[model samples]
Target: MPYLPARAVATLRLLFATLLLAPLAAQAQAEPDGDNSQSPYFSVHSDDPANDRLPLKSTQVRARVLGVIADVTVTQHYRNEGSRPLEAQYVFPASTRAAVYAMQVRIGERQLNASIREKQQAKQEYEAGKLAGKTSALLEQHRENVFQMNVANILPGDEVAVELHYTELLVPTDGVYRFVFPTVVGPRYNGALATGSGTAEPWIATPYQCTAATTDAVGAAAIDESAPVFDLQVQLATPTPVRELVSPSHAIDIDKGADNQSRVRLAAATTIANDRDFILDYRLAGDRIESGLLLSKGSEENFFLALVAPPKAAPSQLIVPREYLFVVDISGSMHGFPLDTAKVLLQRLLAGLRPSDRFNVMLFSGSSSLLAPDSQPANADNIARALTLLDTEMGSGGTELLPALRQALAVPGDQERARSFVVITDGFVTVERDAFELVRKHLDQANLFAFGIGSSVNRQLIEGLARAGQGEPFVVLDKASAAEQAERFRRMIDAPLLTHVQARFEGLDTYEVEPPALPDLFAQRPLVLFGKWRGEAKGRLLIEGQQAGGAYRVELPIRADQAQAENQALALLWARHRVASLTDQETLEGDFAYSQAILDLGLKYHLLTPYTSFVAVDEVVRTAPGTSPAATPQPLPLPQGVSPLAVSPLTVGAAVPSTPEPSTWAMLLIAALGGLLLHRRGPRGAGGTV
Candidate 1:
């Protein structure tokens, strides 16, 4: 200190003071109103006024269920209410495994069907159509579950309707079937986004509806008239009586039609905003999941799907000690309601741990922190201490997930105990592909289970993590459902229903089975297999497994006469599952080995894939001779129960950043210290001042 002159000392003190107050100043500016904080706090207004900015009016969904297969069609109506010609772009979600095979657009009375084309080719065609003053609609897949729709040239007072058709096979678990219709695409946090990075996801640039000024008791934003109205109806048909049919997400009215048929629709009195996921669950009479074969004989190809029921979980007397690492998200998105729900879930999860298990908790946001240096015993004292520490986190900052994941995997552990990583979050980050690859590379170390803790979580990331790690995905739509979901997860982890599974083809000639090797049946989900059959379907399929320390076998006979045209979805379903497998393989072996194969599959099947898209163009010009349509990205509603903190409107075109946030004043101090150290250590010129 004595070596420094009075001038240098004063300069250092002034610099330190500025550094200490910088974040405090920023905090004041960010939350000036205390309710809404827009990052990069500026709004971009279109040339048109707010009244005409939104062209999308309504969306209608209809689903028909044939036993376990569901065919769904979603129709979106875009109306040009204002005087200007408009182009509307909407980003939405779908089931991760949905096979979108068709899309069509209707204008007045003329209807034009969309054609599946290579992604670049489709984009070119859509752009050409738009440039030619023609009406066009383009559908593209940005992620497995996320999609974007672009409709061009809607003249004044003209209403154009676009319908997308897809099919998904509903696999039941624990004799309970679930059908999920994702309604909104939550804002994504892109860690790689930077100026000149060029790799930023364009979809994240879209706008989201803001209603933080008023929040309901459940912390859901109030729906304004600008939101599109949604209507959903499901025709459920089963081979046996459907019992306990219910929807945990929406209030519905059910009408029993036939002996095994039911019509379900959203109650007219209920709110119709598409702000959260629509989920339906049901069980067959006697809670029995049928084990059978579905045969689809196409003119060119023959496909078959098999489902073999696994035995119920047997209570185990011998318990094995295990290691559990719980990864939790405490980001700004979890600031209010979401954070509360996560706390409740973690409480239940920690309390339910077995006394023999060793457990630890890792809370992550911009950075990660561990409850302890190493795994702690699941004792009352440790549990209380851990919970107390977790309770202090109020949830702030960006969601930097990969660093936390790497840290969790790097921890040294005992190889003898079975290990599992449980992650709980809203799954809102854009680094899902990287996360999946990370989990896939470490499968030898432990399995990963993901719990999405919001009304409209990113199912793609949650399910992908589980899929990559050979575990399962769970969602807690709200706080009320957290306890039930947590209990189910704990039970599933402890009980293995079947093991040592093997499937063999007999007289039936089968080829190219999607999953060549089957995993041990931990939950009550059936062993499902997809393949192509040749010659005839008359054969016996045999499967063997171990249950409760005893050998178990099941054989199902397939008859050639049982082939049905109603099972036409099987061929497309097989292709979708194959694409998924190839995708996983592509991630594992990085050079895109399966790229061409996936492209060929998409082209051959005319299905929507990462490599292909659907585009529809009306030949006739829609806009006037001189006027051009204004392109408007549709604003999506804040997924129900999500806080405004999640969608910070943080970046160029409204995307969130993936950097450490000024969560506390201490962060400012740390930054100041860093600057101070750098200043003192930096090299000086020969004639250094003072």
Candidate 2:
């Protein structure tokens, strides 16, 4: 062997050490198997070895639809199987439009109603309660659609139940009313953990748990045997007879009763995993669209909700050349069903394009690539090329959407041609506000439509993108509905029912109307409005807009005396909407006043928000003060239709190395050091070498 110089020898030793440790490090970070279960990413760990994991026991969902509004209640049961006390934390998802109003905590025979407080105040209260050895629970909103529930100081063998209630309005799309209830919060990809505490989002710091199985069967079975089962039921009360009732996501049993009422529940013995959203869709008899006003009276203030239908539009005689830009997400989260759905939707949309129109396709994952530098003519050749590009170049990577969106917006287009930008994705991104701001900034350039594809797509991002883009949001949970969804999208954009719409109140003391300015009406969906009014309820609410032929106007008489006390839900719903609008504005303006307003509104209406939280406590001491309760994270189910491999390191049941054993690097370093020492010692342990 050639004699190596001292510097070279040192360098080689270091390189060898690195090579030995690299794989060891990776394996060490691998997810754990069921035999040695551990928390995945974005989870907090407990100190007590016995209280390592807190398993969710069960989830029950009940929904009641009265007219066009739905009141939903969800109950989650958690059990502490360990010997020591533990603090359980769970991160979950909900509908974007849901107006959460109440939360309750049940411990054995005692039920505690949570009270909403400013976020910081609630956190302080929860910590104090924990320190005082009291049992407590806290509910906080992490994102518009994501929430966190924390239960502190649950004694061993205790089964605690958390109940949450929310209400939302049902806006029919294409004459069909759809209700979505999301069950799982998909694992978020965080490149690195947060450096400091007290960050705005604490759940991001929770550690992640990797499981050993990826397939549906193995994944479902690999979960803790104590994991919770789900039970869901819905009572639908519509004024008109339902022509059909269906649940594409779940096997459901529907019982139709007299008076246009029906009851729906999950089919018997149906093994439902909390991996997919539960969707219920119904069509009314004759497919008629009805619009009306709802009023509610309170001791202090009065509220009103109005839905106005626009006149049907006639077929356009003038053919307008338009430019269409399609943005598709090829992120790892959208590997299987979501990507397939996008492809099917895009094909249908491309086929419907007129020859006079121009289109381009942009696929993005970690980076973006456009089919052409500019928009291409919608001819057979370009369409074929686009399809081929989709086939060859579409692959999964990190979800870097902002850059792709920026590139799409920067693509120069023909000034005279109308522009419509369609975005297809599972919306698995946390930077929703940034995306919305970008769309809002480019509203003058193109009309933005968002298509959310997946069993439990991010509705907040989808709806926000459309609202900012001045268009509509469409969701397709299954591939079978792609064609119908595409057709609906085409019809919605092809004609405008009304434009430049404005609402005016005469002889009414109306104030704080949400969505101060209305966008053009594209479909038969109602124009919904929520506002506060004073004085006698006798006033004329006038809606004005320009139709195909001329100006259009409709007036509805409002009577304050008709306000019913039972409609208190209207007030809470309106407050929630106002808070959402204010939060969006706050995100854009970075104003503290908007933040304060949201906090005040949340406290007033008892709504959980980013600036507010719900907290409940029991007076009795549960755990000792010096002995801290272990912080246990609850694992969420893998979303339906999402492959286990799609999640990689976060796979539900996949066996992954949590930590690597001692690597060869130690041996290499030891050998290298020993060689250097022997070289220094020379022959026979003498100082000098011959």
Candidate 3:
């Protein structure tokens, strides 16, 4: 309540990163991340560092949006600025729904197309080529959205270009279509034993730039020329005329062409650094959605994608007595802007609850605490108490989400009432799969709704949590959108757009459908189905569901004559979806149960996955064994609004920050708490409401 504006809080905290990060970390005082978890370390410019050593120079992106599908090509350019032979490594991110199917590497006049293979096999190939002094590039998936690229054995003055080609299905929500291009992966909170972080996730140890922090109003006082620049252009062709075009994340120029076509590009001389996700949202000219069937006839397999729009949501006139639990995150990474925005969102959500509803609040950091022992009636007094408790919290410490989730699930609630949980966080932890498994197991107990609060949050974790919990995920990038998103959450909880969805294929030889069963639809988004068809594609696709307290049905005719060349991406998309589903199952079981299946799918579709990788090697040797080479990790710019503490202050040859030591921070907190207790006692004795 008595807090600075969220943006102001974020700006001040970000500007003081160098001075406050160490002391804050000391206060949070987490134990050693036992699972061999890696933390980013500060990079030293004096350690023989040169511009050339930062091999990654820039990234160029080109994308085309055709109706409900998007095809994107990203090229990473690395030029060895150092005089000796060296290898370069960079960690980045992509859309969680991206189906990366192709990769290519260019060395001078020679161009080599990469091949998909088993992950270990690809690693072996890259290592062999590195030892043989051949230039090579390897791409691997660390998380659903996180990826790593390693370009090895770059000789002096040599340049390398690695290109990734991917496609994603664009599903519209509430008539608005959004495309997200993640530039950098945010630092993750590696918990105890790091059991969930996959095998030696070295990408977490990358360097982060911390020197200069600024806001949009202040712009960048000075730009780092050596740092990578971002360039992107998107050609959008919709089925209907465009009613709106905008990008809330960046400055852009839109050139509207004839018949629902437009060209969008970064504003002239306005290219920015790769520090945050790029988002573009647009709406078509009409209230109706552009949803239909798409088909692809490949040499070996025929694919079909069906997009069925659900009916609109029903009115919420009757209130249901619900048991609600609000789980909040107050970790160090959410210290300022994210925390402030979360507060606003919680205020709107709790204040809007009906008096008949029962609710409780849980706040988590390196630990967690509840507002009350049990769920309390949504009265003014209880709501006020919860708000007061949240207002006193200062975001600090590591994100211990799994422990908090387990505790929430154990809380007892009324069996007669529908149980629902609202989890609000930036989703920066590494235990995503474990968390998903936990939610999936107790799904009968409660449906969890996740609100991702940050500029560039971990969408993979948030989306995964919702998917496993059989609920919905919402992202609020700023405080201004808090009320809007909160209202949407309330609306969704009132009723789903469609339920009990069943798809029937008549006369169509469909096999290997991505999801054997369909889940209820909560928004205005279309119901999507991907599968392969044998022989002719002649059939009727019938979908039946319940909508707005009434029976709803949709029927569409499918024909082989409708197959298009552009729809070839459907084959890759289907394979990717299958791999994703299998990966989730494997994670839920805490083992590699479906690794082989996923690997086979990746290889067959020429896509990338956790069990598979893309590797390109130039046969010509470029260096000799006698030459001493170095391995330099490309340093990334800290995500917008993220402080420096997101990474560790410890690194080879890096200067440790001068701040209160760990012991001093603990001692200081004890004294402050004691004094605060005494001060509150005095206020009560003076007949004041403390």
Query: Total clashing residue pairs per candidate?
Result: 0, 27, 3
Candidate 3 lDDT score at position 504: 90
Stronger candidate by TM-score (2 vs 3): 3
- List TM-scores for all candidates, in order: 0.88, 0.85, 0.89
lDDT of 3 at 638: 64
Candidate order (lDDT): 1, 3, 2
Error of 1 at 132 (Å): 0.6
Best of the candidates, lDDT: 1
- All models, RMSD in angstroms: 9.4, 10.7, 5.9
* Model 2 C-alpha lDDT versus the unseen true structure: 0.77
Clashing pairs in 3: 35-193, 35-194, 52-81
Q: Candidate 1 local accuracy as lDDT?
A: 0.82
Please give the ranking of all candidate structures by TM-score, highest first, separated by commas: 3, 1, 2
| TM-score of candidate 1 to 2 decimals | 0.88
Candidate 1, superposed: residue stretches over 4 Å from native: 1-51, 193-199, 269-272, 624-628, 649-662, 665-690
Model 3 stretches with alpha carbons more than 4 Å out: 1-19, 22-37, 46-51, 194-200, 215-222, 268-271, 626-628, 649-690
User: What tens digits encode model 3's per-residue C-alpha lDDT throughout 331-435?
Assistant: 767766778889999999997788889999999877789998899999999999999988876576767788899989999999988899889998877778888
RMSD of 1: 9.4
- What lDDT score belongs to each candidate, Candidate 1 first? 0.82, 0.77, 0.80
Per-residue lDDT tens digits of candidate 1, residues 554-617? 9999898878764669988999999999988898888879888999999999899999999999
Whole-model lDDT, candidate 3? 0.80
- Which residues of candidate 2, in runs, are more than 4 Å off? 1-49, 191-200, 205-225, 269-271, 591-593, 644-690
The TM-score between candidate 2 and the true structure equals 0.85
